[model samples]
Target: MKITLFEQAAYRYLPPDFAEHHDSVCDTPYSLVTHDGMYSSMRNFLDELMFGARSGFDGIAVTEHAQSSYDLMPNPNVVAGILAYQTEQEELDVAIFPMGRSLGKTREPVRVAEEYSMLDVISGGRLVAGFPVGLSYDASLNNGIPPIDVRGRFNENLDLVLRSWQDPKPFAFNGRYSQYPQVNIWPRPLQQPPPVWLTGVGNPATMQLILKRGFGFTFFGFAGSKLTAQRIFPRFWELADEAGLEHNPYQVGFLQHIAVAETDERAEREYAEHVEYAFHTGLGAIPPQMLALPGGIDIRGVQALLRDPSDFGIYWQMRQASLRDLIDSGTVIIGSPETVADQLTDLCRQHRIGNLHALLGFGSMPRELAMRNIKLFADEVAPRLRNLWQGSGFEHHWWPERLGGTLRRNLGEKVSA
Candidate 1:
């Protein structure tokens, strides 16, 4: 199994009653923040990411959100650029992953292409590009894009981006979402295309596109993997099969909230409140109506989700979710190193999850405790799970070549029976 640290730059000093009075996103209160608090939060978050890179993590990841209290990252590429330079300076061979900037939401697609290309160049080809269609709220509410046009905009913008990176000569792009009289990126990516990855939320069409276009599919499982993975992964692989693609595990990535300590009891005591804070103030606080606004989802998809909301798993009740509710439903894994290793290994092996984005830093977790958790996980848990897919006969096509990924094609031949 390949393990990496996935953290959001959540402002860590929200009051105890933050959830009772304010939502985590969109219209968060500025009265809750101090300038020092803002600087410290962002600084600490960056420092932690650098710490993860130097701590022997395979990769470091962050995502994009706007006007959110929990995750303050408006542009993930800026952070990715900083990581690129830092890791290159330290000679860390870790992938710099930006989960998404919402191609649909972006007005400047060429700038997006330039940033990733520069990141690849700076890191010497260590970039795993993630392009999510985007959340309804973030793209529409924050970026001011029409929810109905999001997917179409994403498709057109993505085409423009890929060609912008690969085309040796400048060319005109007549995209519905964007138009460029001359498209030529100065620094082409070091890798052929830097391993394009896409996020899918149980969308058969998205899954098919990931398989068909040879892009890696990443599933955050923020709702709770145990509750949603069985329904999602099987459906993903089934779609891959129907598309005549191999069931290559590397085609999939799953992110899970994880914490570790000397004992399961201790782990819970230390992490439970933070975990609760994460869900209650983060995903739980976002209004559901804002999440899937009409036209944000495909017409049929909206109907399917309405008829059977099981795809969302335990997300509906997350606002008042207890630690036990989170753990039982597998929204998080908090335990002794032994316990965490066992659970994570089983999850990867059973689900054939090639990439594991272990979320170590969550809502309001102090820097000290978060660092301790990272160290413990790196020392105890990561070592044990590193070889889960060693003989599984699968090549990791999703990782950067400089980090030991094989050629992107014919990966299915390695799948061990």
Candidate 2:
């Protein structure tokens, strides 16, 4: 299995103490916590990414969000640029920005895609493009579009971007939200088409689209269990088969929070504090009012479920049971390196999961703690997993290595070397 580390770039300063106070005292739709400073958080996150790269993570992941404490990477391309430059010097594939939240407005996404393509050329095509039909409220608010229209726009935007990347000559695209007469996108992605991964929350329609389009599927595993994944994965495979595409298990990626330490007890103790902060503060930032808007089933369901505390007991119980099962089934893959590796191996063997994307620095985990977890996971856990997968006929067709080398050679020693 190919292992990639995902960092949410959660602000390190959003401590549990501060979050508890906000829960009890704050009443506004948003809170400007002291830890929301951008520069320090970016610096720390960059440090962590670099640390991960040095420690031998196959890829470093970045994502996008807006006006929420869950993640602060509003412009993932900028982060990608930084990673490309850093990794170029080290001569390693740094799969940086997976641009998210570009639902429609071909101009912006096309421009961003063009820029990323240039970055890919500079980095020799190590870029991985992640597209998503973002949550209703944030997508609408940030893009100055309506919540209801986001999905349609998202679909159109993705089409335009893909066409722009693939088409050699200028073309015209007349969609509801975007109308472009000239579709000439310069600096075409170095990797023919840089790997495109679709981020979803188990939306059947989106999953079907992904399978039909032959794009990889990446899901957030925090909200569901192994059974949830099992339910979703088979449908994805069925859809892919129906779409007449090759059934490659590597095309499916799952994201989850992971923290490994010397022992399960220490890992749980350290991880629980951050997990609680994530639940209370990170998730708390999403106003109940915003979630009430119309959109995908998961968001709508979660919103409806959260409406009445009494009604949530069943959901909570299911969620708790699911989480325990995930832990037992080795789906979440947390705890000591030995235990985590054993579980990860079993999970891969059982589910035939090829890509494991681990969200390492979630919640308000301290920089030191986050770095320590990265080091331990890389040193102790990754080696064992690598050994297990070695000679197992798992394809190592990672995108970064293929595209990034071209960028390095073109930019010469100063920029790419």
Best by lDDT: 1
lDDT of 2 by residue, 1-417 (tens): 557778876665554455445531114224454544556777788888888888888787777776566677677777777788888888875566464535532237678668768777777777777877765556665556666667677776777777787767889877777677787987898776777777876556778766655566887665433545665567677777777876555667766667798999888877776665655555445554453355433465465455634321222332123334435533345789898778767655555566677777776678898899999988998787655445655443434456322111121111000
Q: How close is every model to the real structure, measured as TM-score?
A: 0.97, 0.81
Q: Native-vs-model 2 lDDT? A: 0.64
Please give the clash total of every predicted structure, in order: 2, 11
What ranges in model 1 sit over 4 Å off? 409-417
Most accurate candidate by TM-score: 1
Q: What local lDDT score does residue 274 receive in model 2, on the 0 to 100 scale?
A: 68
User: Per-residue lDDT for 32 in model 2?
Assistant: 54
User: Tens digit of lDDT per residue, candidate 1, span 194-260?
Assistant: 8888888998988877786788899987898899999999998888778787878877899999989
Weakest 10 consecutive residues of candidate 2 by summed lDDT: 408-417
List RMSD in Å for every model shown.
3.6, 6.8
